[model samples]
Target: MVIRVRDLVKRYGNLTALDHLDLDVQAGEIFGLLGPNGSGKTTAIHCILSLLTFEQGTIDVFDCEMTPDAYELKQNIGVVMQNVAVFDELTVYDNIDYFCGLYISDKAKRKQLVQEAIDLVALNDFVKFYPKKLSGGLLRRLNIACGIAHQPRLIIMDEPTVAVDPQSRNNILEGIKKLNQAGATILYTSHYMEEVEQICSRIMILDKGRVIRTGTKEELKATISLGEKITIEVENLPSHILENIKTNPHIATFDYDDHVLVARFIRGENGLVDLLELMNSSHLQLGRVYSELPTLNDVFLELTGKELRD
Candidate 1:
């Protein structure tokens, strides 16, 4: 394991922030930590990095016990927090060079690493631009370049794609894949379900300071009762048909609006076929019919309760 936490607990007086949280990150995989705001995700990371003192439990990174004084261990790890941390006075190239210089003393090596980092994030054109002059997307790329310039074996990114444009988000995701291909293990934390489902090889869903489920995307979807969602676009849906769909044992629920009927089935394989047959028998003209598998968001809502815990 690249990182291992056993019975980790953090308490503030009588309130428990982390209650016996256990987690593991495998080497060379994009592991995602999914949670809402204030779900103790940040606290767990702080304790693991020895930034915050925890009341109990053990955190080991690279088979060595993590400590506040573990300078060597710290050198091999790179952290890019949710909040952007970069000097507005420094240019993109200078920012990357400064961070890389911390781990590499050789001037030539640092220069090469900084350039490589800039290229990895496709920030070569904006190398001379200062943070204050760059767009939100470009600034985020610079932040990534600064953190990853050191070429650490492990990289922890917390909401690295927050508030970025679609193009930049895709660029970041592609860069992460390239890093994994180059043999850097990554720990990613994000509340965006689609983002997590897209790039993560394995996922861990956390709620109330505890890990509720951990597995691949397919495996995670398997944990929920919802099997598939089938949507049909029809000009008109009879009132009786809508009522029948709602009352079906296989169907969990459905919504009808704007000449569209979306039916959700909870654990029925032939539900879509049945719905299609019913529509045909009723002479309903179906414009579009599509069946979709459960998403990480569906599994998240099902396992953590429908209520917003954040």
Candidate 2:
């Protein structure tokens, strides 16, 4: 295992940030950690990195205990947090070089690593530009470059793509895949469900400092009670048709409003065909019809309630 935590607990006065949380991340996989605003995600990460002391449980990285002074273990790990950390006085090139120098001392070796980091983040053109002159996207790229310049075996990225342009986000996502292909394990956390579904090999949803669900996207979706969602646009959906859909054994939920009919089917049900047959027999004027499979967002919202979190 790349990372393992058992019965982890963290408290802040009377509030429990983490409650006996258990987690495991294997090597050669992009493990996604997801949670709401206050869901112990950050606390768990901080404890795993030994930046914060926990009340109970053990955290092991590379099959060894993790400690604050574990320099050798820390050397093999790289972290790119949500907040940007770089020297504003230094240029892009200098910023990357400064960070890379922390892990490497030889001037020649450091020079090569710095150049690789610049190229990896596509900041060659802005090498001489100060951070103040760079855009938000470019600055985020620089932050990532500084973190991965040493090419650690494990990389933890927390919302690296947050508040960036679409182009920059795509570039970062591609770079993550490249890094993973080059034999670096990644622990990624993001609020964007699409991005997690796109790159994560396995996902774990956390709530109230505990694991709510953990599995592949397909497996998680399968555990939900929802299946395909069928939507149809009609001039007027009669009450009788809506009642029929609501009473159907295959449909778990039904809603019709604003000249549109939406029906959510139970998992493993062939409700679409039946609904189409019914619509055709009724001779209802259909403007548009579409069927959408359950997505990661659906699974997330269902498992973790749709209430707002602080």
Which numbered prediction scores highest in TM-score against the true structure? Answer: 2
Q: Given candidate 2, what's the lDDT at residue 133?
A: 97
Residue 87 CA error for candidate 1 (Å)? Answer: 1.0
lDDT of each: 0.88, 0.88
TM-score of each: 0.94, 0.95
Give the clash count for each candidate.
0, 0
In model 1, what is the error at residue 203, expressed in angstroms?
0.9
Q: List the residue pairs that clash in candidate 1.
A: none
**Tens-place lDDT digits, model 1, residues 260-301:** 898888864559878988888899888989999888878878
